[model samples]
Target: MLQYLNPSSAYEALLEFLAAGGNVLVVIMFVAFFMWALIIERIIFWTTAKDGVIKRAKRAWAARTDHKSWYAHAIRDRLISEAKQETERFNGIIRALVAVTPLLGLLGTVTGMVEVFDIMAVTGSSNARLMAGGISKATIPTMAGLVVSLSGLIFINAFERFAKKAEHEVSDELLIE
Candidate 1:
C-alpha cells in the first residue's frame, strides 16, 4: 500500500519497464494511448450525442407529411442512414487500431528473436545474461500489444452494440409508414 502511494517509485518503475522493452514498446505505447483516447471519445459520444441525434432524426421524421409516397420513403431511408453513420462513426478505425496492436507485438517478437540469434552467432554458445535482453524485448511487446488490443476490444464491442441498439431505437422512433 505504501509503495502504491509513492509516485516517484511508480514513475521510475514505469520508465524502467519501458526501457527494458525497447523501441517497439514505445510504438505500442503510443498506439495504445491513441486507441484508448478514441475509445473514450466514443463512450462520451454515446452518452451525450446519442439522444440528441436520435431526437433530431425523430423531429425530422415527424415533420414529414407524405409518409407513404416514394420520396417520403427515400427521406426516411436517408434519416436512418444518417443516424447509422453517426452511431458507427470511427468504429472501423477503432477496430483497425485494435487489430494492428497485436501485429505490432508480433513485429517486436521477430526483432527480438533476431537479436537473440545474432548473440548466439557471435558468442558461439548460449549465455543467459547476453540473451536476456532479446528475450525480454521479444516478450514485453507481445504482452503489451495483446493487453492493449484486448482492452480496446471490450470498448469496441460495447460501442458497436450501443450503436446497433441506438440505430434500432432511432428507427423505431421514426415509425415507418
Candidate 2:
C-alpha cells in the first residue's frame, strides 16, 4: 500500500483515470477546478474582507447627521447597493460553471457512444472488451459531472444564504434613524 501512496504512482493513477474518462473528463476537471477556486475565494472573502465592507458601510452611515433627509436616504441606498454588489461578485459565473459541468458530462457520453458505434461498424462485433473503453468514457464523465455539480450546488446554496443574510444585516445596521 505504501507503493500505492507514492506521488508518481498517484500521478499515474490520475492520468489513467482521465484517459479512461476521455476528453470530456478533462474539460470537467478544469471546470470543476475553476468553480472550486471561485467558491474558495468567495468563502475567503466572506470570512475576512466581508466584515470590513460592512463596517465601512456602517461607519459611513454613522457619519451623517441628517438621518431623515431625502439625500441621506439616497446615500443609504447607494451604500447598500455597493455592499450588495461586492457581496455578489463572481456568483453568476460560479453558477454558470456549475450548470455547465453536467452538460459537458453529457457531451462526453455522446462522444463515447459515437466512438462505440464506430468501433461496432469497423469490427462488426459487439465485443464487451472492445466496448469497455467507450462505456467507461460515457459513464465516468457523467458521474464526475454529477458529483461536481452536487458539490457546487451545496456551496452555491450556502453562499446564496450567506449573501442574503449579509445584505439583510447590512440593511438592518444602516438605520434611517
Candidate 3:
C-alpha cells in the first residue's frame, strides 16, 4: 500500500512500535547500531584495505631471494599472522555484541512480566486491557533481539569465511619456493 511506502507513516509506525516495546528496546537499538557500524567498518576494510595488505605481504615475500631457509619460513609465518590480525580486527567485539542482544531481550521480557504482575497486584483482578501493554513489551523485544541476532550472525559468518579464505590465499601466495 502507498501508506506503507510513505516515509512519514513508516517513521510514525516505528516510533509507535518502539514506544510499545518500552525502555529495553532503546538498549537493543544502541547495540544493533554499534554492531552494524562495526560490520560496515569490516566490510569497508575488506573492500578497500584488504588488497593493500595482501599486496604488501606478497611483495615482501617476493623480494626475498632466500625462500627455502628457516628464517624465510619464519618471515612468511609472520606476514600471514599480520594479515590474519588485520582481517580479524573487531570481529570478537562484533560477535560478543551479537551474543548479548538476545540476553538483553530476555531482560526486557523479565521486566515486562514484572510490570504485568505489578499491575495485577495493584488492580487485584485479571485485566486484559491493562496487561496488553506488558505483554507487548515482553514479546516485541524478544522478537527484535532475535531478528538482530540472526541478521548479525549471517554477516559475521560471511566475514569469517572471507577472512579464512583470505588467510589461505595469502599463505598460498607466499609459497616457499
Each prediction's TM-score versus the true structure: 0.94, 0.96, 0.93
**Model 1 per-residue lDDT at 117:** 92
lDDT of each: 0.91, 0.93, 0.93
Residue 94 in model 3: lDDT: 88
Looking at candidate 1, what is the lDDT of residue 16? 89
- TM-score for candidate 3: 0.93
Say what the RMSD of model 2 is: 1.1
Per-residue C-alpha lDDT of model 3 across residues 1-177, encoded as one tens digit per residue = 679689999999889989999999989999999999999999999889999989999999999999999999999999999999999999999899889999999998998999999999999998999999999999999999999998899989988998998899899999988
Model 3: per-residue Cα lDDT at residue 92: 91
Best by TM-score: 2
Range of the 10 consecutive residues with the lowest summed lDDT in candidate 2: 1-10
Arrange candidates by lDDT, highest first: which order? 3, 2, 1
Better of 2 and 3 by TM-score: 2
lDDT of 3 at 124: 99
- Candidate 3 lDDT trough over 10 residues, lowest sum: 1-10
Q: Candidate 3, 126: how far from true, in Å?
A: 0.9
